[model samples]
Target: MGSEIAVRVNGTLPAFSDFGSDNERAGEVESNPAMKVNTSCSLIIHENGKPTKHILVDTGNGVCNSVKQACNDLLAGRCVIDAILLTHSHPDRIDDLSLIVKEFDNVHVYCTQNCWNDVIKKFPDLQSIQHTSVEAGKTFEIDSVRITPVSVQHSNDALGSVAYVIESEGRKIIFGWDVLTFQNPNDPLLKGADLFFIDTFTYNPHPETNHLSVLQAYDLLKIWNPKEAFFINYSGFADFKNAENPYARVPKKPMTSDELAAQVMSDTIPWGYGWNERVKVASHGMVWRSTKQIEFMSPQFSEDMVKLFTEQNYVFSIKKGKKALEVTAETDIKNISYEFIKYDVESEGRRIAATTKGGFLAKPLQMLLEIDDSSDPAIVKIKVGGGTNIKMIDQDVSYQKDIHVKRVHADRLRDFLMKLTS
Candidate 1:
């Protein structure tokens, strides 16, 4: 196995001056472009292994010098940046591109063809750097990681914006910035991500066609259900110090940092709900490492309770929780026309004792299936069955047919109990 993948946040732009302002006191953080240069740029992703590779995303003003200094001080120059990926052609997002090209040799710059043209036209003097054009939906590999671009709506329609999905060793991550909306809701490329960073500019819902509001971001998280999500792209309106009407209903004071020797400024406006545990507001200098573990629920099921019931598997459907579970099965395994009886549940040890009222031709049956809820994201312990109480409807007799299964069903029950707190 190679080393682990790491993503580091270099800076975050301060929110706009009027962000989260009420009829009362207006917020204080200025929306000047000069201040944005200090906050809004840089992500250094180190894909570990024998041949470790470092990839940089976005180059806001001063990012090149900061990252260059970090390489020297942090790793003794062992990890050198190999490539730079642009999210858009906006000046705040690419102010330090020329400096990066001048400082680092043979660094390939990748972006949409439209963004590439915009960059050249805006900065004609900086043509020496190698420019590589990438199209949406196309994928490119660097070391063990595969990256794909998907189109996103933004204020700068002429330059456009693209969100990237990076996959490596069964792990997936997404990076989206300055995004307004997605072209498709069910884009397979955007689903089942392990971790993602998205644009969250305003706390309240906004009718603007450009930036995403906190409410819109919450909707997207409910759909994707990533293991973790971070909100970026702040305006001055994001001032937590003056926030009187927070979207999450709870107010949080500014977070201080020991490294910076100052209060760590935050732009996050959290919204509490079931998915709140998996998402947070982002801060500068934050880092994320990929674990490559399937401990969290996918689009369908994980360790705890099975949350999905698909048409493909019609024989049985399940609804599970911390202390209660419901399993519904069809009377006939092969036919969808017959009436189905719901399984009544009672807990015993690790198993749930389930009994079904006899169907038209079937006799009442009792089944036992084990469930283990000791870990996060738990799994089902055994297949659905309590064959002892089950009898044929026509014969009115009991039988010992096992509800067969192959894996450790307990592994499927990770966090149903914990979800109660969520």
Candidate 2:
């Protein structure tokens, strides 16, 4: 087992539509990639600094598409969700539940009984999948991880919302959201966690809403005394202008990103815990990693595939001025020490990116930009083609969409294919 648990914040907004409500916020959401939200949050258990098991929490309305991209791009088709845990039946949280089940092969889902009933009514077609009805205070095991679902007080006790407490290898994590407060106030399990994810709503409490205000959550957070805390599911601006509370300070209508940061910072203070970093506002794609994490090496080609490229025996003519490979005559392809080209390909509904790291990373991996003499007419391209099992790497790629080649040391691939073959 690896020593680190990587918490990837897949999504953070209450709903994507929250930003669309106002034109200015909508513009910012479009302009700033970080401000854009999706349905999110997943836990990746790492072994030897590589991802082994993935547990997804809350598949929001658009999370499946994002998860699909992550599965292909970041994970290089290596990781799949071992299990999915649902917190409630809110549209923003469970709308994409069916999509996620279909995306992955053979996955199990666990949701509280109260939530499960609503889930079935919402998607009757999903009743037959591998699913389990869980109850609050029940503890279950997945691999080496222990998960306990503790019921929390949301607006509806009828829907049966609960927060998950995950423990593994002496590391405890609380993934709490859409909460009013813990139903059992004095539950010993709520305190002293290594990673804490709590809900932060408007600056002031609104009785009609299910979520806890920043102040209410703050009071509970101080007692928990976690090493690191992140506030997710936030929609905090524009409500502070009308604070009726005597203790609360006032802020006006326009809240810049800077002011929001400062406002959030003031509330998230490390009160005598001797910690430097207090609570953080979790953003999309944010990762909270263990101190022992090593740089992940993305999946490279298989050894069998690498052996296929040796047919060309190191030949290329590189034009440094134009940053392209040059070949007109069959004579232009010459025997050289190496032909270094940084390239990307998006084909067959999958993305592959190759880059030169340090030096000589490609030769051993055999991500070759070479010509094949085995075919009758001969084929000239990167070591990728139809029916060839290709693997993706999280290395340098996609400088622009489609295929972006930083530098190629051979004939322009299209010219070589058409001129020689035709």
TM-score of each: 0.56, 0.64
What's model 2's lDDT at 186?
Answer: 67
Candidate 1 residue lDDT tens string, 1-422: 55566666666553233334451212222333322333333333434433356677787665776676557533446546677888888776778888777787787888998888888887897676787888888899776668888888886554557888888757788888678887785797887888888776555544363677655776887788788777776552433533665454322322212111111112222334435446655555455666432112122454443532211122333454435345554321222221114343334334444555555764445544444455533334333333335332223322222222213333333233334224
Prediction 2 global C-alpha lDDT = 0.60
**TM-score of candidate 2 relative to the true fold:** 0.64
Per-residue error (Å), model 1, residue 238? 9.0
Worst 10 residues of 1 by lDDT: 256-265
**Candidate number with greatest TM-score:** 2
The lDDT for every candidate, in the order shown, is 0.55, 0.60
List candidate 2 segments past 4 Å from native.
17-20, 23-27, 30-39, 72-76, 237-247, 252-258, 268-276, 292-422
- Alpha-carbon error at 83 in model 1, in Å? 1.0
